[model samples]
Target chain A: MSQHPDSPARSNSGSHCGRVWVIAMHAFTQLVRMKVFYFLAVFAVIAIGSNFFDLPQHTGPEVSGIAVLSSIKSWSLGTMTLFSVVLGIVATALLLPKDVEDRTLYTILAKPVPRVDYLAGKLLGVLLLVFVSLALMDVLMSAVLQIRSSMILNQQMDFAQGRGWSAAEIASLRGDILSQGANASLQGAVFAVFLRASIMASLALLISTFSSSTLFTSIISFLIYFIGHFQADARAIFLESGAAGTGPVTRAISLVVSLVLPDFQLFNVIDAVIEGQAMPLLILAKLTAIGLFYAVFYVIASWFIFAEKEF
Target chain B: MLLAGAVRLPLEASLTGELRAAGLLPAPLAIGTRDHIGQTSSAVALGGLRTLVATFLNLRAYTFFTECRWDDVAGTFDTIVELAPHTIYYWETGAWHQAFNASSYYLNDSNLPSLRRDAAWRASVLNGRAFLERGIRNNPGDPKLNAYLGFLLTDHYKSRAFRDADATFLAASEAYRIAADGRDALPFLRRFQLYALARVPSREAEALALARELYQNRANHTVTMQCVYFSLESHANRSLIDPGSFAVSVFGSAQQAYATLTHYWLRGSEHLPVHGVASALRVLEAQLGIPADKSVFLQHPAQDAEDE
Candidate 1:
């Protein structure tokens, strides 16, 4: 097979990083051309529309705009989660089969490219797509939230001034509104969304390595995604079940299930952020470590299986 | 995969516990909540769209609110809070629906017998209080929820729903105290706490100290706060100060003291303590040469007269 002039495999200074970048960018362009970014438009609408959910509040002026702020974060982050996960799984599940069907995998393997680099590149591509999409969504969410929160603060200040609210009261109200606005915690939540999607993408890559078809990979990935949310609960039952008189058989099964499934519940700190809780950097760092751990393990596992497979 | 899972399982478990302790992760969904949210919502909620499901249910609860389906409103909010227990909006809205909207609905429904209507109204108020108390439990030290509980306890009409006045005022004071302790709590919350505490006869000494502390800040010298402070002070030092002289010193003049004390005295439905108010009003009135028939004491308390 003839190598393209721009191919990393043909470069004079051949490096794994260069080859992975080339393949990852190729995958990104391929997926982008599939018009996956179009979902960002839908996300824009959802984020902007969430602002209008300013339901007639029953509380005093102190909490006037809070529900709307929560609404915006909930709708925005929720849409990001859904879109990123779907894009991560579907885009990844499609990549391997599409490459095979196009005979591109054969051509790539025919080159000096390592299979692990190729797998890493492809997973990185899906992750890049998910990260970019979430970043864009986060920007839109932050913009809408900032503007709405400012408007709310102005209205609340006017009301407070009219009612002769003290300086401390006014400051307190402003602090409350701003806490729910565009803040570092909200950014951390968007990053958490990206991390969760990255895990899904890499996991889907692993599933697709041995999966018979795209449909099989997608279905299995989704099932595992849902079941992964419950893995922590199963683990808990196993850990604490000794005194609860759970039979040995039950404990053993729970242990096996817990040991085999990814614990997706660890990423659910996003919910608390939506409720205006602060996300400590330490926690986000821990979550990042977990995400990297999962992705790296799944990708290596995929390579182990793919390394021996006959294409 | 097993080895990887085994290695990460402890880390994951520890992280899970930490996240939960930090209020970053909610408790696992209860089985009944799963049934309540139904198949699709439960699936969505479990799929990491818990807050999204909660937002949708909030809309649904609004519909139930419009149709006067109080039970449906309550049930839907039950599921909403279960999904997003950390969101104070859902908790406050749920409590409002029960205490204010549902109670008022039953209050004015003339078709039912008065006894049944009264029972339903009182039950709705109690349910609202229970819901707010549950919210406080879930979000301990949350200023908004605590303030809300305090407001519900001190509401003119709703306070009647509580069977024990002293315990009700004590609880309200405690709630306001917690609320005032919050970092962003309004300064008024502290004064409100003092107001609630002063109404609790057993807590008058503590309330007096708080009132003095609050009064040192002139911003807290609202008419209600001043009146509450004066009454609490008199209760704390009943034998130490002359009612008329102390009243004048607090209010700056006998006429001003009489005017402030009269207003406070007439708001009997608020359940505020009177202490030296009536005696001070009498001395002020006598000194001002007010006629017997025109005396403030002869005028019935406004809310008491309305009740009669």
Candidate 2:
């Protein structure tokens, strides 16, 4: 049932890409079932209202397109990312344990599907679902903004040209632009959100494969998320207790931790992205590549540990 | 889809491999301040992207803004404009930050060689030009942005023979026209009329007209309040009669904020006037600690009240 570790290519003739597609579709379907997507759309609407409320409106609050876009990006994208992580983790946790309890894993392993193919499929499913949901929500926000923005431009032109326009008319136009801009911000592929969700889902799957009981997997996965951020702090302690003997001891402890847990903090890019600086492609790629590498390593490690257990 | 390319992560194992190859640090005390950059990094292994790279990017933007590197701040401003084409204040704030704060820094980085002072001044002038350009692009409707842009363009045209003074001044006039012609601008336009009268005396009719509008429009109410408040606060201030107006003006919402705090103060006070006096003095002193000039407003009244 097990493929050799040394070989990169699996002997199974089933296409890895096809299997991944299947997994992604399945994950997307699962996401819809989670009801979190609805939660996100509602939350985004709330964020839009909040942005509207913050406007320095007198006759009415005026907003430019830019303001509307940014508001949507921060409020909607931030909310969506949180939803994705929770959805991904819950989906992975629920699916993994259920498969084991039903002895479904044994039935699947008996087939030609490689362990790598299985792991990749599950993650791909969740990601594709996230993409679809983001696209739909982004479209709705943009359409509303376009109509509102057009009204603003017309009113501003009237005022500027000496064709008398009321202060209310000018303000309403401004408000439209701002509302639209806040909405427009949601159009960017929210890197911080997607990366975070992917890492969390992958980590959850690893926990599921290791723990025999469902309760243990839930507890352990949650702890790993919180503790993973502390990897940098752990290294500080390793250095502080004398770099020779106690240092080596501390270093060993940290290394063991790295080996055992995924570094969740690597996916944190929310603050910089929100401020509107373009993150370099290479830097983002470097982080994602690192994540893919960890995902592969962990899933395979889980497979090895799990294959030995007689379900 | 292309942005997904940014999703790549550097394998931590590469760093791990480097640490294992070189061996350990020699000195024990050296570990306190620093150590082998690679080895200690793994031992206290933070996610490299999360810690080091993100820090560099965030710090770089902050330092440019704080250190008054107008060019760098302008570059960042432009990037932010692109990144958030929808946010109105993002562009306006960026322009203001560059012109007022960041550009001020280029006029001052001590590291510039004495020979580069001429070059630095030229750079500072260039920084102002770039900042105004951003304002023009993002905040075209803003009178302030147009005024700054026109002033900058005119200065460059005259000083360096940049050949754009007419266009720049035209733009400035347009901004002033917007500010002066509008209903909101009426009060401000009156101030200019008054100032012109004080300077040349030929604009007396215009000044009188503006002063009449100030009375009729009642838009000058806030200004009157400010003048009256200062007079009274300064008159009442002393060792026994301190004024809180200066402190409240700093928050700009001092009346409302002090009112809320006074609710708590009222519960415990014996001499209501003394409490008011002490509270006012304490707030004034606290505010004066930083904005020393605000305390200067009290100078005339303090002296006159003492004589009285």
Candidate 3:
């Protein structure tokens, strides 16, 4: 069994990974040159601007410094969600048609590369761009949040000490303030954002495989993104719709849609984490597993449709 | 495609179950709220910016607040908190709007008849309290909301909203105690607990014990704390405690004791037990050479302390 130095199985696996990497890097470079990273500058401005929104007009004594931290997180994460999903879909949607128009698709497909590799490489590329962009935005957000949180903590500490807060009370106040600041949970939230975008990129790739135009792919992907949130509801209804006395035809339709659609709401853990709830590592693992599950399914699905298609 | 779908259906089901059990996903947006937020926002909210939608709703709620649309304010906050249940600010701000601002508006609205205004004001206060209680249920470990609840319940000017003065003070004291139980609760919160406890007629003994514990540290000897300490001791023990000597010892001087005790004496709405306040004031007035007409005795004690 060990006699062969090079086997076709080993060669195929190695070449598949290598080809995917090459195409992925190429896609990354293409998207990067599009000036997509400019959004980080806008994100920087937003992360900084959210610090000054000391709304409610009255910063009462009971108002801890956590409110501003919460705002910073909400605004920054919200912006990241918008940017990542849009980039995921649009970048991925553009990759196939643009490559075909540039004849890169034919040039690559003329080689030994599989369509799965081509699609996966393109998706990985869009994801890489999204991951880098989100990472930069996360850095800006974490830094802004760190500086602002420290300033607020100092002000709160002064206020607490002036009012003769106990050591325990001061410690507790510090804990509460720090909870809303940059931490592991916040990082997890950023990762969750990336996971969501990754799924979107793969879904867009699936759409782009058969889509007539980039606009059609983008529109359909966006529509699916929105509808994906309701997939859970549809699934729930389909599950209970039978027992709940709903018509069989409607239940059958819901079941079909639910089976077809990805449940985007599963990634809404970002909202929970931003609201200061700790996301257990197990939940993140489950989310990542599901994300991978979808990405793999969609990529394979794209390859299925694209495998025998003409230019 | 069919095989992939077959494999994914069960996996997605189990993942959804785990996520739902983990409380990561919120309930679906109500159709009414969806219509209100409009199609674009509904799309964004459903696309995972529920919190951003909530933040925008907060701003809209603020506008409603400024316009004095109390029902709209309440409705918007209801939707906002539902979207971001763990956000303390929305809960607190919403409760405050209902209890204080909305209630105040109802009280002074010239268009409403007096009787209707009274009912509306009472309803607003009750609604605000219910909202805060709901927030507490959502976030039981939060000290600020607990302290806010205590402040709202025990507010002297707002006492007309509650039926039972003593029971209300007891509830307030309990809320303050819970807030103070948090390791980060300010030192004043501990004394604030004693203040609320002092007003509870049946809790004087417990309040006295806490006051004594706080009094050991010279730093806890604020004027109110001193007055509460003197009042609780007098209320607990009928004899052997000379009010003047106790006040002087707590306040550190005869003139300061008189001034502080006299101020405490006049705050009738505060519900702090008069306890030895009057007796201490009488002795202080005699020693200070104050005229009988200027004495604290002639000043009408607040009915709050007497009612308890």
Candidate 4:
């Protein structure tokens, strides 16, 4: 895919895309060598272990025997969410300090690479790692869910048959069981997890740009993460000012918190999906838009801060 | 950073509004629940593992179940369902643990006084019903919740849990009717409707109509359905139809009719009406080989067992 020798891509690597891609690949390789993908093994164990939760079986025909399928998706996706967010935050937080510690920051700055390219490239690399980890975990989850769903489907069909259910009833049972299985909605949910992690990664990048140390960045980023879940509530309080008899200082504080923190709760459609609710593509699109907005704004802010740094 | 926040705040607000309107996001976790979950759990749950936290709570509830801590079981499930209100399994399991397991434990508890045991048993059943009703409200279109409600209302073995038998059956019939709505409803739900409605004295006409409609389907020809159909038909308009013809039509032969009617007659716990069963059984048994010693009247002892 390399350009011809005379082309711009081959000349001095001055093209921003070329430089950024190089850095991103370098950073991706750097993170990958850290053995971060080992978490997928743990994820597989969780996915498989969740399948064994059908204890004290429900004793009626009203519900199918496939509650375990839902349990599998819930546990797997939950693990995926935890793993992805941690990876996104820690990896992004580690990048800048580790680069500086290795003196690669100096060498890279000694080149023609812009600081923005370096930061953006590092963020992209973390994103790529997160995306790849989530994709692997999603594949494992979908596979387990698909297999378990088929087994549950068979069990339900047999149970329905023994109960002499009609074709319509059997079809309904099949649909219910399949809804809890791996489907497009589940894929959309996994993507929502990824989107949440992506936003966290970028936010960590922004924090790391001004942060004194990796530990500080990670801690502050995590604090923001937990607080971000309440950002909407703060926004609501600010929006409905004086309804609760609060004063102006409280309102100002809430407004600042709401305006600053990314609302992490919006990505919680994953919970609904785990509950077997259908996720409309339009809703996923809206969530994607929100994610992109946060990610882009954070990266640009990081660029603005890093652009003038004496390092 | 503040400039970026200023530029994107409205956009974030607008998208958040849209997402909330679309029901793609849940409301913020309440402060009380945050306190209940504590700092570590609050952090993990807010970190996008809310359902995982709910799952752990479910396991904890199960442990409470093993230890026979009924209140703790109930409390953990309350937390679990709050974390995952859309999950039917949590609701169903919670209700089952309360209504069946915990209630049964109370019923047989030798340590408790009789009155206290009875009160605890009743409370457990009621709590389970309330939980299921809450589950149904959260998941309005779920046939499983409706069907489960119907089962609980009309359960023969647990009839003591309900206050008014007639009203309970009527409510059960309604529950089944809702469960049977749409093309995908299980055929048994409609049959269950007929069964429950047939037991309601004031709803005999409506029950007979449903019974007739469901009788047209071959899959609804279970013994209970046939018994309900015969009883409802007799209760609705006994003067219009001959008992023997109806019995033969339903059970295929005189002997089979007698035997099936005898079984239905003896199931005292089921609360089935014997409006036409006895007279029809008499005529059929007289024609069949039932001797004087083994007459249909001899089955009164078993029928009386249902009253006890």
- Winning candidate number (lDDT): 1
The regions of model 2 sitting more than 4 angstroms off are A1-16, A23-69, A101-103, A110-112, A140-189, A213-215, A230-266, B1-308
Predicted structure 1: lDDT: 0.88
The numbered model that scores best in DockQ is 1
TM-score for chain A in each prediction: 0.94, 0.68, 0.94, 0.93
CAPRI tier of model 2? incorrect
If chain B of candidate 4 is superposed on the true chain B, what is its TM-score?
Answer: 0.90
Highest TM-score: give the candidate number: 1
Positional deviation of A250 in candidate 4, in angstroms?
2.5
Q: What is the TM-score of each candidate against the true structure?
A: 0.95, 0.44, 0.88, 0.91
Ranking by TM-score: 1, 4, 3, 2
For model 3, state the Cα shift of residue A227 in Å. 1.3
Candidate 3 residue spans exceeding 4 A from truth:
A1-12, A38-66, A150-177, A239-247, B1-23, B110-113, B206-219, B239-242, B245-256, B301-308
Clashing pairs in 4: none
Model 2, range B1-308, lDDT digits (tens) per residue? 11221122124433322322321101111232223233433332222121222222223555676555556665655544443332335545565564445444544657766657546555555555665566456444554454444444433222342334334444443554444554333334333323222222233344344445554554454442233223233334445433565536522555543443333233221111111323454474465463556442243222222222
Misplaced by over 4 Å in model 4 are A1-14, A48-65, A151-173, B1-23, B301-308
Ranking under DockQ, best-scoring first? 1, 3, 4, 2
- Model 2 lDDT on a 0 to 1 scale: 0.48
The stretch of ten residues in a row with the least summed lDDT in candidate 3 chain A is: A1-10
Cα lDDT tens digits for candidate 4, A71-93 = 67778888888899889999999
Who is ahead in DockQ, 1 or 4? 1
lDDT of 3 by residue, A57-136 (tens): 32367455567677778889999999999999999988889998999888877766677878888888998999999999
Can you list the residue pairs that collide in candidate 3? A168-B183, A169-B184, B268-B302
Q: List the residue pairs that clash in candidate 1.
A: none
Task: Enumerate the chain B TM-scores of all models.
Answer: 0.94, 0.35, 0.89, 0.90
